[model samples]
Target: MSARVTLYSRPGCHLCDEARAVIERVCTEVGTTYDEIDIDRDPELTERFGEEIPVTFVDGRQHDYWRVDEIRLRAALGG
Candidate 1:
């Protein structure tokens, strides 16, 4: 089974970078698949998450923002 994760982010954002590292590691360890969407690519997404570029969603539900918790992510993905 694939665990789907969505990341709302933008270019040149340090926080987003950190979040990516955490998500990437956890996702890889758990065999979870993730989509990284640049909020700037979508007007609606930009308007909604512009201020929180590093937002992460697990199964379509918001999980964290600005920073990612590796342990929490692993638990969420049932890793």
Candidate 2:
């Protein structure tokens, strides 16, 4: 099964990098994995998340943008 958490990001984005770290730490603690999609790879994605490169989705619903909230993520996962 795919991971419940999805991160939309692009290369060389400092905020994206920070979001990844938070997602990684939270997901690991919750015993779950996450999917990272590079927006730069898809024009549609790039347009959709142009300003919000570090967007995060939980359970197929948009959760956060530009940053990943560790406490909220852990709570969402019921960890």
Candidate 3:
């Protein structure tokens, strides 16, 4: 389930920060990597993810919203 991890985020988002921390920690532990996209920078992304920031995508599919579950992320990444 875990391939490319993408964090759809925005500036000044506390939840996004938390989610990013979890993603960074997990991905580092698992030797995986992720990309952080500021929704504010992209119109389409901002529109799609406007309401729910801190959205996560695994392998280009939506995984979690608003938060990152470390255990679930670890399992999904096959760690």
Off by over 4 Å in 1: 1-3
lDDT of 2 by residue, 1-79 (tens): 8999999998899999999999999999989999999999999999998997799999999999987888999999999
lDDT of 1 at 40: 91
> For candidate 1, what is the TM-score?
0.92
- Model 2 quality (TM-score): 0.96
lDDT per residue (tens digit) for residues 29-79 in model 1: 887789898999899998898797799999989999988988999999999
State the number of backbone clashes in model 2.
Answer: 0
Candidate 3 Cα errors over 4 Å, as ranges:
1-3
* Lowest lDDT block of 10, candidate 3: 1-10
**Cα RMSD (Å) between model 1 and the true structure?**
1.5
User: Candidates ranked by TM-score, best first?
Assistant: 2, 3, 1
TM-score of 3: 0.92
For all candidates, what are the clash counts?
0, 0, 0
> Which candidate has the highest lDDT of all?
2
